[model samples]
Target: MEYNIDLQIDKQSLIETKSFLIKIGNKESNWLGDVSIHHQATDKFRLLEAVLLDHRLNVVRKIKAKDVYTKNADSRSTFFDDHLEDKFSLRHNQFPYYIKYSYRIIKRDFLFLAYWIPQYYSNVSTISSSLSLTRPMDYEIHLDSIGEFTYSSTRAAGLITEKWSIKQPKKIGKADFSPPATESLQQISIVPSDINYGVKGSHASWEDFGEWVANLNSGLDLLPEEEIATLKKKFGHIEDQDTLIKKLYHHLQDNTRYINVSLDIGGMKPHPAEYVLINKYGDCKALTIYMKALLNAFGIPSFYTLVESGSNPKSIRENFPSQQFDHVILCVPTKSDTIWLENTVSYLPYNYLGSFTQNRKALLVNKGGSQLVKTPALTHTDVHQTNTYHLTFEGDRLTGTLYSKLKGEDYEKIAYVETNLSSQEKKKYCHKYFNNQGFELIDLTIHQNSRSLPEVELTAQIDLPKHLRQVGPLRIISLPASTMPASEVFKDRTRPVRLMMPIDAHDKVIIDSSQNWTWKLPENFSLISEFGTYQITYELVNNSPVINRRISLGSRDIPIENTAELYTFLLEIETYESSAPIIPTH
Candidate 1:
């Protein structure tokens, strides 16, 4: 079954109607017809029409007023979508059936609208989805699609425009990896072209938008003298601006939980700081507001930055400037570096921007207006995982003392192991630094500082069978080959491959042979590719062999044609690692 939704918008007011045709294949197939609308305190939805049809397209059941119902969505979460629906059942219906329904929605707030162009119309070989938009009065509109989609636009009337049809729609495949939405579909971002929130501010340009945002919250940005004095008295000794910024961020985190209450202007205007302080809870917008207030009290300046929050990085349409962001964050500028703070988290390290906001573009709203800026890019240097191992072998029983530290996104990973994982789970992770097929954890100890992104460390001692292979008089020692478990295998894949996470890792293994043993070190080996670099070093110092291997990926995106080369590069590195051996003489 497939469907199409037609929507009409006039600023904050909107009307949406959808029609779905379902075919009953067998007795086990579904035949119930349904139409639904989701609404909230400000915006609303109303079901307009619903009908069920038989084989001859004859109307079987017309939705009665009693068929509609509304209820609370879910009890498990505080924030959930609530909706009303008009439903009809055809349990005894024949094989062929048709269903159609329509509903209208009042968005009320036009800060942003996400319209996903329909792609699944499979009854026929191909079906095209279209969109038509008309601006209110003299306002302008903006629309665009990701790279995969091709579209053209035509004017209808008084600044009225219509995207007659969408082109180059690809069928959904069973491939495990998903390309970014921006690259997969055409997105129609329709706004009043003026770029203003229409609440008294001119958002025609970044500077205007920033000034308007600054003026919009001018009163909320202030802290009472008593409140400022109290906050200062509590933190009078913290001199560093960055440290103070972090301290205030911690204060905001400690003082509030996220309570979502969309009212008045809806998701556009943020709650006042005073209200949040008294209520002890606020959403992302409110938290950012309160954090800004705290910083203001301390003579520090920060801007309200809007961002699309997610693990996946999404960019603001550089060419089109409208409401594209779903969340708000606070950006603090300083002397040595600009500090980005996530006021929602109490435990993440200060100034440590993880995947949620890292490497994405954001709208920084300040007094001068708004400016588009990029978040910090997580590199091998910022997000690194290093493991150091000291090993000794005696009678096929290998003992290793391993210490490791995870930084950046790598650290962002284990950062939750301490508080979130059970002791057994933590031990399982600790073993990864030392475990081989034949190894056993003799003793393990772990240390961590998750309150900030300083680092997560693990120390372990393991016993394993001697990996040494004796080739006549020369003893061969092949260091354990490090690996990032294979996440994707696009064997015989025809489509473009989606680039996965960038890897930045280094492993150091120091072997202290029996005091009487000596090693003949091999010359260091290095290989640099367009993707990344791989290197191996074998150094024998005072009868102990020090081995270091580094894998630093240069980019996170790659074309499909390069998959074979990438696979070969990784395979060669694996083979080279296993083949390179230290020759130790006893």
Candidate 2:
């Protein structure tokens, strides 16, 4: 069964007529659906209210009165066509029907009316329609629902209006819905259709759309053949199949800008490719088709591919043919691979496919026919980040320099910050990146190699506070200098212990002392807590003490999943210290 809907709306607050035609087997069912529109009344002014029409042709059921509502008012109304029949049914078990409905509003200011068009099965009883017997019965269905809503308001700006449509289907008893006698219900065909109408306050009309495309196509003929040939010779160089296709693919990506424009005005017929080129901007369809035409001029084979931009994973069934795509792209065929090009961003990479297009199936529409194509897989090797740092300590002050290199989408973020941020802002940014480490930055430098790669290298010299040292007979403290005894720092003994220094990672300390300052031994000193490699190496150089302390305490590789553990580990390492009391040496 197939269904079709047609609607026409005017500038007045009236709907002339909304019609529907449903085709089931050899018979066609027609219905007239319309709504009498109204507007809101206000003091010193009156505005027409936008009207919404909801009607499905395939489903035969009662229309409830309470299903509709009006704004700022308590009452609602329900009206039906007196000349048309109330209900209709189909004779064939596997055919589809069409339903059409529309309405209008007089005031151009209230142009934002919308509709919540329900699916056909929402009103139908599935229990009664269930087929009997285990025999195979093939069935297919198609749905075409369109809404043209318009409104204007003085409080709001100009008139806002739109017309949107969708086509969906329901299939039963088949493996992946492949058309054949492989499973039960092998011989069934169903098609559903619908149409809708509304009004808008604009001088542009459907005829203007057709004229625009036609005139643009005619203008293409005016270009000199020699110039066209020259353009082809310059742009078309396909030495290697993959390289050629990739170049052509990148050509479209670098040339066109994407603007979202719908086809309800001209019923999905695209504008002239030459016009789009002059404008340098167009909708997905216009840009895609333009790329296709350009490739054809250069003896390259290409096609238009349509797809939906969401997470729905159902494949398209050939038994049902209807427009279900929300986006359009270009597909170039080469000896080795078929390249997909999206003509939205002039800066997007030639081979980089966004998450929206990743691993999704698309319909490739060519002169021959439509075929399905799956997007290539994305691998972890395509993404990576590298960081390097140099650290040194001089007289209790630690100085370090850091460099970071990023690839893939991560580069996009750092590149923007690198270009826009000032020197002071960059210091603030570095502080944040280092977990708010209290360090004085001496120098900060950022270098970007390429915009396409979107990679940035940052280098900075930073000074950190000195907190640990030994004095005279005993070590003053192994803990950070910021820590103080509770007796002096806190008046109340019950007060919580507080440390001034922020702890992020474990630290290692090496000390070189002069032999003239003789060290006294702490007889009672003992190790308290330890993790990983916490060792000290002592060597005598010219009778002087050269002490090397190495500590490996934190996880080498931080896991995002264990971020909480990492934080806890940081806190634990910060508080860790040897508390064993030192005994005076004789």
Candidate 3:
């Protein structure tokens, strides 16, 4: 892969050309032979060349650029944007072949010059890769990368050319529980010091970026006079700030819906508050500003906050700040506490962030500019689960009732299931977690409790006829399988391992049989490590075998040096699971 960028300082534009030489090894790598070019409607794009070659380097076919299909990027009405995409696929019956293609994109007044990822996947090794950039000698730019690369620079006439390259890069297979690609892969990003995309902006600092965003969204948060008067009259009797904010937030949720709006400078600038009030629908940016306008009616203050929102969010580079945020929320600070409002979803409990936006740095866009601040973090108490089960055997069938309670992220997950799925679908979903090869759900119920950090309770009754097995003279009782990682998962691991999510969970199981059967007592033990802790206890109460187990995992990224310890800890869990086989003796 060869990536080149030419910075036209005088015109404040960037001309990027990318050429790829990919080999199609199998049916799966056939995706590499496909061509897809994405650009905004306002930008200029040209496909210079595309050809398919056989194993002998002879031209098998020539792909014409005119033959490609071009259409709107998004066909859904909920998503409105000015972007276009051109795409075509290359498929052949030959054993081994090569595909070569090159394209150019011209961007006028660009903020980000290039974000290059040479390696397509962890299984694909790169033979050779290079990135070359030519710009005015005096013009300033920002460049960042993940790992070391061979770099050099040369100056000719009035232009400077810098090159970064990698040779015969080895393939690094991804392991289970590995961190996100952006954190564990090789990448590079380049940005100009100053730029304009309808609204002027600079990449020199976070303040400059925020100032650019502030200008785009300025004077857009106005409400009608009659609406303001109505709001004032309605909230006139309420003196408490928290109650007023809650009322306004609930009003925003009830009156407005979320959509994707990507107009006016690529949707960086939000639509006006009046648009939402009149249309009753808006995107994240629009909804946030609408909520801000509602607060303004009663003289309350809030900031339009930008955040990188996801279950496992991309880490924000504080030192090299750029346009890293993808979602917006409203931040309101009172005397006693600070409130964060995610106005996109109507069903989310008030003042709840869940896992999407919690525990991350957010940029607060204000009139003066922007400032970085930390959002609330989650602890074990916030993301935890507890389940209790009582099992009874009747002839060859096993019947059990499960009582499950969940909080934080778990609550959010179940809440989605409760809202989106039907009763039969919910029962079908419960079968997967019951851990039996075959089972029937007798009853299933879910209850959602609304609070700042809400909780959900799931009650289920299940019948399993395949669990109890008779092996010669021994009768064995099978329980739910543990989710601990197996040894084969960490084999040939090269990258660091990290816990996928923060978890604290406990489970209790009780067995009762009409026949007076004696059981072999399993030893109780506990193992603790930096990654997390595990414990299990077994006892006999009222002639029934009672077992209690717990596992608490901390959210930590374990470096390569510490992975041995993680492997050891997981092996202990596997051994403990195998050692506790429930068997009945007469």
Candidate 4:
């Protein structure tokens, strides 16, 4: 794949002329045959030309990008479609073909000058790529890049011309638990030092960017007189600040839903609190501002926070700050501690950010300008979970009741199951959760301890069809597959290990049989290392064996050299718990 881009910046708009040359190597790379150009609703786009060429480099056909498709049709992720794609499809019969297409986009409201990524997809090699950018001599911009590239610049006719090129890019090997591409990929980011996103703003620094955000959202938190009266009438009597905050947060959740409104500065600027109050729906930004307004009604102060929120969020370029955040949250400071609220999600417990927004730096926008602050980080204990099973073996079958207590991300999973799934869907989910080990789920129940705390309890009664497996002359109890086995997950890892959160889990099992069945107690095992720790114990009580196990791995970015040790630890755990051998007394 090769990309040739020319960017011209002026006071009114930024114009980008982009051309792509993609070679389809096989059936897997056939997706390159289709061309897609993405742009916001505010931008003007035009496709100049598209041509399909054979392996011999002769033009076979010409295509046009006439179809416009909405960017996201999934209602679950996007309530309101905010972007469009200009698509050109070229169907070819032969492999090793080439597709060339070029287009132009005029961006009137943009936060960043350019985000040039030469290699957009994984496992795809780039032959050559180049960028020619021109801007006014007085305009100041900052450039940040990862990986190797060549750069050159010149000044002529009161304009600065900058050229960047990447040739024969090296391959990045896949690895288990690798960091996000933004952290590891070869890319370039260009940020302007000042102005223009429908309104005046600055991208010179984090503080400047945040102050611009504050100014954009200024006076958007004002509530109507009646709304203020209603709020006071509902929660004015609550003297405790925490209780008040919870009440207000709950009110916001109950009253509003999330939608995307990208009309304002291409969704960079949020709609006002009054809009949400009247419409009962808003995007993350609007919902956060609404919550802020609700808190401010009672003289409580909160900062509108911007964060790159996701399971594995893109790395934030803190030094060259631009509009990098995709989600908006609210940060409230109280007497005892600070509270972070994810206003878009009604299912999340109050003040809980979960794994989506936790353990990351966020920009707080306030009257005092912007400040960077770290969100709450979870330790192994924070995500602790326990599973207990009481089992009885009769003939070749096993019946048992399992109870699970989940916290942190585990709690979030079960919470989602409880909130989103139906009775039949939950049953199917439980079967999959148990690794589909031929266990018949007789009964399953999900329980939430409280609405304030993010925790869940699950009780399930299951019957294993054939619990006993005869190996030679002995019977062994077949166990569910390990969640992360070394062979499947940690094998041939080339990248450094990066964990988003720590893991701490415990398991206990009590085995009894109506028939006189005895089992040899396996020797206890324990291992501790820098990667993590593992321990398992066995006890004999009333001719039955009670087993307990615990595993913990701290959250950290470990280098590739240390992953071998971790892989060995995981291998040992996998070998030790493969099956349980049993002896039947006649």
Question: What are the clashing pairs of model 1?
Answer: 12-108, 140-193, 210-369, 210-370, 211-369, 349-452, 349-453
Best by lDDT: 4
How much is the lDDT of residue 146 in candidate 2? 27
Flag the better candidate by TM-score, 3 or 4.
Answer: 4
lDDT per residue as tens, model 1, 468-584? 666776657666556443324544544455444466779998887565876677778887877678887777677677888887765455567866776666666766666666676
In candidate 1, how many clashes are counted?
A: 7
Candidate 4 regions with alpha-carbon error over 4 angstroms:
65-76, 422-424, 436-440, 465-467, 478-488, 579-586
**Alpha-carbon TM-score of each model against the true structure:** 0.77, 0.41, 0.91, 0.95
Candidates 1 and 3: which is better by TM-score?
A: 3
Q: Which candidate is the best by TM-score?
A: 4
Judged by lDDT relative to the true structure, which candidate is superior, 1 or 2?
A: 1
In candidate 1 the C-alpha lDDT for residue 244 amounts to 82
Predicted candidate 3 versus true structure: per-residue lDDT over 415-469, tens digit per residue = 7777668987876666665544365778878777664446888888987666678
Clashes of each: 7, 30, 0, 0
Worst 10 residues of 1 by lDDT: 75-84
Off by over 4 Å in 3: 1-10, 74-78, 421-430, 433-440, 451-453, 464-467, 482-492
In model 3, the worst 10-residue window by lDDT is 1-10
Better of 2 and 3 by lDDT: 3
